[model samples]
Target: MPDLAYYASLPRTRGAAAALLLDDLGRVLLVKPTYKEGWFLPGGVIEAGESPLAACVRECEEELGLVPRLDGLVCVDWGPPRDGVDAVNVFVFAGSLTAAEIAAIRLPPDELSDHVLVAPEKVPELAPPHVSRRMEPSLRGLVEHRAVYLEDGREPGYGSAPLASAPRPGGPG
Candidate 1:
């Protein structure tokens, strides 16, 4: 039984997935997932009819019972989709949570086991390899910038509607 990280390491098809680097104080959030047991940020595939931002918020609510305020594009990774097979498109968001927000925090336990807040610099110690590979840059960039979009070649310009749509593996527009 290969784990999600193993799948991420192997060769395979490309797809869209999202991740969240949630911050509370000076610590980032991590989860002990059901699929593989190591820690990764909260996020999942962008379901049909679902927008990227919605997916991020929903993933948090579904897994952690907290609806994170969408902080916009932090860093986008291009890779295979899923665990134990290949890498996936990991959309990491540097988001915020209020004290009132914590009051609403709930854990479903089905998707995630328990959540922990780790020091920004100590994230790699708590994060999975694939996740940490992408997380380290975004987490560090956030301290200096309000946001960071880690796409190879892309540009963010005005779009039509407010609905959050997933950009091509290239990155946020």
Candidate 2:
């Protein structure tokens, strides 16, 4: 086994988790952060020792004041190093919200400014490119009951088999 120091010296990768929430109309729910320029999905960075699904649920509650019953995994994207940041992994979960849940949304004034439900196709217009690229595949995965793997938000080469029936890490919603 590698020494503790040796293991500690290995590169560390960051993780983040987000949810793809939809309304009964099939419109995607997006949030506008006070600290950021563009809209984002309801999510945030994964804290130490926290699972992606847990992080997603926590973030949703923190940002939107609601805990949604997330469905299966939608996408697992490996974001390449860019700018001055190291590579990071992002996990997206899918779920739908009832009218009551939508009505209960309450943004933290310091963190988020507003929330909107938009057509999936319009995601590209509001979100950053990296986030936009994940939308299509994530939406498709939700519809196909599969999970997609992406590199820098795009599938690599010919793409691998869809994890349609694979056991998801987080149990069912």
Candidate 3:
């Protein structure tokens, strides 16, 4: 076994959770962050001791002022270190909102400036490339009822096939 010091010396990856919320018309809900340049899914970093799902729920409420029923894991994307930043693992959970919920969305003026419901194909134009790449598998996962694992928003292999199996409750089969 590795010594405690050796284990502590291993690189650490940051965790973030986001929600893939869709409206009744199947348009995705995207939020514009006051601190960021482009639009993004409604979510933020995972705080210490918080599970991904819990963080997703909390961020949705904080950013949009709506409690969303996150259905299940849609994608687990591993982002490689880039631009001098450390690696980050982003967990995206799937959910949908009713017309009432959509109308009730209220953004925090200090954090989010606006929100919009756009077709999936239009997401690439508003969100950054990394976010856009992740959205593809996420949307497919929602329709296929399976979770996908990605590296930098794409499957590990050369093609679009999923590299990892859908996660099970107890363990992977």
- The best candidate by lDDT is 2
For candidate 3, which ten residues in a row score worst on lDDT?
A: 158-167
- Checking candidate 1 for backbone clashes, the offending pairs are 4-83, 4-84, 7-84, 7-85, 7-86, 8-86, 80-87, 80-88, 156-173
Q: Which stretches in model 1 have alpha-carbon errors above 4 Å?
A: 1-24, 80-87, 144-173
Question: Scored by Cα lDDT, where does model 1 land?
Answer: 0.64
lDDT of all predictions: 0.64, 0.93, 0.92
For candidate 3, write residues 44-163 as lDDT tens digits: 899988999999999999998988988899999998888998889999999999999999999999999999999999999999999999998999998899999999999787445453
How does model 3 score by TM-score? 0.86
TM-score of each: 0.66, 0.88, 0.86
RMSD (CA, angstroms), candidate 3: 5.0
Report the C-alpha lDDT of model 2 over 1-173, residue by residue, as the tens digit.
75999888988889999999999999999999998799999999999899999999999999989899899899999998898988899999999999999999999999999999999999999999999999999999999999999998898874364556545689763
Where does candidate 2 stray beyond 4 Å?
158-173
Model 1 poorest 10 in a row by lDDT: 149-158
Cα error of candidate 2 at position 55, Å: 0.4
Error at 61, model 3, angstroms: 1.1
Candidate ranking (TM-score, best to worst):
2, 3, 1
